[model samples]
Target: MSMPICIIVSPVQESADEAIEGRLHLVDSHDPQVPVTDLGVTRGDGIFEVIGVVHGRPLALDAHLRRLANSAAMLDLPALELEAIRAAVLKTIDLDEHREELSVKIVVTRGVEGTGVPICWVLSFQTDDHRAERAEGIKVVLLSRGYPHDIAARAPWLLTGAKTLSYAINKAALREAARRGADDVIFTSTDGYVLEGPSASLIMKFGQRIWTPSTAQGILRGTTQGAAFEVFGRLGFATAEVLVGVDQLAAADAMWLASSTRLLAPVRLLDEHDVPVDHDLTDTVNAALLDTAR
Candidate 1:
């Protein structure tokens, strides 16, 4: 038999049904009741946000909502009843109710209309990861699409800021990296400046400061990266938002990926090179990052 899509939510034995190409249906406390054949999801006409659930509360809830709101507005999609969605998220969290960190995702799809399929799944998943080795860091590959226009746009496009469910390109990029025997891909501009990782913001240190590409670089604004920046600055490290290349980062004292769930993980290797961590800087960055997440 062909392999079933791996979008299943393995939260303590909950079941999954295919909801869309890259998503699945799972039981929840307050899940939405959309039809399984809704074309919006079947056609990738949707938006989503993967939330970090801690202590039963989703971290950066406001930020996720803000991004979700932006994506929905851009897609000309209807406003998701926030109360209903929040309830579903919280309900899903209660399903497994584990002690370790978990992720809860919210997906909003445009219901099919006319020849289109009808609306569907506003759902959440309790994601469990045992890869604490990530605390050390992740190795990433920098691959440039020679301007990235084929797969992405900086046009006055709504999807640019929206967490749209149309992530086929994103998945492809990561696959390319895996093909190269790497864990993740760092997409660069035609000019060789970094944009972001396939699913994260870049956090590298140069001199005595922490730096990430600015929004002018045309990348998703990362909440965890930003929050950690504030905490990094308060802890006496200078922070910057600038465009630096693979080589520039290679010269940095340390590197890491910042996101809601990982908090911080050092990047011990870059490309084919083994980039060692400057122990002092790593400690400072780790302490600063985890403290803020707490």
Candidate 2:
């Protein structure tokens, strides 16, 4: 008897460019040949990064790659074939030149249970909801992460700052948020410090200044947030990394969830509290993000 193969094809965007569609690259993009013994599948022991593609060009590509490398290092994985991964990313984008907005995920699995080899692959697909969320904004609810702000520093084995595949809790948090009538979730530390969103970073505004939770507070360093901050600085906005609390969020001028795919999405409501949504600021931030991303 043969093992059943699962060939999953990524969905391309309808608004993508007309040139590249209805095509798949077997070796590069889609294949159902993962070894069942791979630790990534068995134990969720791996690292990954997702980059946003705009006009066939990946936004903040280098930054995302750097973060991927960092995650690999944190996991003590074998040396990454950076050049090969870069080539694969470019090839994936080339295969879908029509993708107006795409999300390319890079995954590096700690090979078959015992093998020293690592399985690295890139998967590209068109994103559907980022545009809508960015345009209309989103509602979020704060949930306790059940840990103190300094836990990451004390428990390095927890992999709190790494983008590992063990994201069951994060997904569960989002589902819980949806059940409560919110689109996303913001995790807070037990000590009452705001950490980050399940799949994005948190950014709050105070007048013309922007603030994000410090990485030292146990949040993943955000690539898109860093890029957006650079653009914000150019636009005459000050940026800082500090410990933010729910009370501070309530008093802020506006708040947003920033990520590689969504770029910058204004938070219109937080845990039923109406957050101040500055339309003009959102537009300006969005434009700057696009320009800087390109």
Candidate 3:
């Protein structure tokens, strides 16, 4: 394992013409940095994006940055200098020696209480090995998200679409899955709509058609899912995003949890029921995803 590298970005929001390089400063990831009073620490008032680095390049970077901006806007934080953040991400990646497989995390906090400024940093670290999960797939249990499919429209304040730092619920769901003797969880809406995995986007395939849950259902838009769709499209598979029902899982020819770092892990078993796992197709999709550029 390699030590994580961090780069602090001062004045997260800067002019387009400003030199972003000078604003980025490399620091020890293990040392204290953020103030104890920061709202991200005190209230989890922040947003974050994780970008996977393959070989020496970052994958789906532009999409991840766009999502980060969306999250910040949803949180009512200051308009971020995306170019500056991009520079900091690249700098952090360059500073880290783990180039084979790494995950870059971009975090923007609401800053300390009483201070309106935002705190931002980019951290790059080696990713976990997901060979086993990707090859043999994972077992998952279906859990209720405790909200309806229309939650985003019903309560925008819930920040459903935003990838905020508050993830206690997601963690708890995974713990529940563990209690149920499952590897992961696929959260369903109270009204029986299939949502997504605790930390992944759910992808289901029915013959030639591939589908993922609609993002309007209060789920974060998935960057890796979009990339996977591209791969599926190239392979002559029609792709679409629609509202999926919990009962639809049993009818699917195959399903997988798509995420950064892990890439794609087929769901071999759902709620203890065996799910069809197309190892060959899974390998193809993952290979294309790993080969993705930018």
Candidate 4:
């Protein structure tokens, strides 16, 4: 079926019968609804993943699903109905009709009041500005994440490893960067360790070695970062996962923020100071990242 772009608040369970066709598609229905009581809505209790869709096919499907499952596990949500989620994503893409590059977002919430059943759905939309930024490069600023580097190990309940829907802080960080005339933010620990970006992973090139913020440092395990490192190794680059400092980023040969949709966007400036961006390395690494088909 078809419907205008609207948010449907479904008091009833979303069903396949409500599926629609358009520039956007909601996986089991045209409805974009969940009850106000849903933990995802009221308290931002949920896990989500955004995946790149190229030519109507989701890139690194299994890896994405694995991360989704891991996110859910970290949140202590129910075991994911993997096959169902997979079907929803594919169906959402198939129904979109336009096969241009897109982003598929999968979200699973921690159930509403009175019903332990989780809320899960897939939404597909046109790719965002990251596509252009990947080519033009971006300016970044280092901001404090306000946590010590080892907070994740010391306090597991912080959900540091999970990609939860509670992104108010992340968005605020980005907004603050914009206010400062910067394009994005690279978060640093309160104790002066480089963490990551608000929504992307940090990869810095120093001499012959490539480094990413360690997951042990309370950062999300960046799927794109891992994939890029594999590609980099194949391209004859040595890589490592380390605890980096904000000072190191300022002096790196080159740096980038990596994510599924953005792929890899080089940092040309940080904190209004110019980074010695290696254009050749940037282009080559970006090419390798794109060629990974992820």
Candidate 5:
């Protein structure tokens, strides 16, 4: 494994004219940086974004930054200096020696208790090879997300749409999927509506239409899924974001989990039921996604 590159961004929010380069400082990834009293560590009060890099290019950067900002607003954290964050991300990517494929993570946390300031950092590391999952596909099991489809609207404080550090439940869901002999999980709302995977977005094809569960249901708006939608639209597939019932998974021609690092992995089996794997189409979509990075 390679040593990760880390860049600390002091005073996360700043004016454009402010010297951003002065604010970004390289740090040792192996050493402890975050304080124990930080809200992000104690209460999981923070927002984050991951950007995939291919051939030295960051994928869907603008979309990722936008989502980061949205998450900040949802958490009521201080406004982020997006331009500065972008510079830091690019700098970290440039500093990283491994250039084949990389995952860049941007994290902003409500600072240590009693401090109104926020803490931020940009880290870059090599990504795992996901060719097998993309080629052979993955087995998935459906699990209840323990909320209704309208929970985001009913309980705004739940922070459904934000990409925060509170991923214990998501990790537990994956473990549960493993116990059930599956590679991943698709969360369903209490009302029987399909949600998303633990760390990926669910994209299903029914006939010529490609649909992803609406983000309105409190799922994080998938940046990679948005890029995949563009590719599907160009290929003449009718694309949409709408409410989908859990029962509808059985009727799909094909399905896939879309994420930043893995790119796209077809779901071959849903709840032990064989789901179609469109290898050629999957390759075509993956090619486009990789090409965008180039």
Candidate 6:
């Protein structure tokens, strides 16, 4: 049997003609041309966004731009000209020869010379995945509390809220799950408060209401999480940025990990506990979100 197909587009380019007001005049916005010997390659000096675009439109793009700028601030990179970046993205998608439904990753590396001094590149990749599974739900393994580096305090430095390229820990969490036979991992605080998945936000059910980890929980505010909560209001499901424990998760009628690509995956399994799926609630929420996404 063939393994599932995962799309990969490399060296995505940005427009050089776009004006940053100050960055450049009539610049071609070339891909990062720094030598393979650049210092950032060894020292990770960039920010990025894994955007999901459908029907040639980006989802929550403005929100993503806000987070991107925040991430750049956390890393002390140059101030990101949001409008310019947005235009570049729109232009890039228009240039994308492959038009199938795709998820695009928008990336911006700190300019090679100084902070916002010399941009490495603003790259975006358009991918095609036929086997993208909107999982029935997910099997989330609860991992240790708060980040190993006292993320609670140093999060501003680490940009917990910003979706940056420094995802070594995130990758390791996913690998640890794969090795142990699970789909994804959920980081939990010692008190059992849920944080988030390696790459997605944690959404759980509490009775007829919805709950997610608050900023105090040090979870990155997810775009999908934001969108879903909007639906929660319309659907009359009480939603809050509250902290939840595994026991609460086990007690809820449903659970899910929401993201752009995953959309809202019903989490049927969490660690050793097997959750009884509520297809009705899942279906309702999915339809509502899909409608809103459009």
Q: What TM-score, over all chains together, does every model reach?
A: 0.76, 0.89, 0.97, 0.87, 0.98, 0.81
For every candidate in turn, the CA RMSD to the true structure comes to 7.7, 7.6, 1.2, 4.8, 1.1, 5.5
lDDT by residue (141-188, candidate 3, tens digit) is 999999999999999999998999999999999999999999999999
Model 6, total clashes: 9
Question: Compared with the true structure, what per-residue lDDT tens digits does model 4 show for residues 166-196?
Answer: 9999999999999998889999999999998
lDDT of 5 by residue, 13-72 (tens): 455567988999999999999999999999988988889999999999999999999999
Candidate 4 residue runs with Cα over 4 Å from true position: 1-32
Badly placed stretches (over 4 Å) of model 6 are 1-34, 37-40, 113-132, 145-150
lDDT of each: 0.63, 0.79, 0.91, 0.78, 0.93, 0.66
Better of 1 and 2 by lDDT: 2
Deviation in Å, model 6, residue 17 alpha carbon? 12
Q: Supply the global lDDT for candidate 2.
A: 0.79
Clashing pairs in 4: none
lDDT of 1 by residue, 1-294 (tens): 211111222111112452222233444334445565555457788777887766556777777777777777778775544544555555565554451346766666665445322243333344546245354556678888456432344564635545677888889998998898877777887776777776788888777788897756657778778777877787788898886875586687777777777666677777888866665555665565445435
Better of 2 and 3 by lDDT: 3
Give stretches of model 2 more than 4 Å off: 1-30
lDDT tens digits by residue: candidate 2, 1-294: 221111122222233453332322336223465689989999999988888888767888888878888888889997665655666677777666445667788878888887777776677776656777887889999999999999888998898989999999999999999999999999999888999999999988898888999999768899989987887798898899998876777789888999988888999999978888887777887787777646
TM-score, prediction 1? 0.76
Summarize candidate 6's per-residue lDDT along 57-148 as a digit string, tens digits.
Answer: 77788878788777777777656667766765665555555423556666666544443353434333544341233435667788874553
User: Residue 25 of candidate 2: its Cα lDDT?
Assistant: 32
- Residue 121 lDDT (model 5): 93
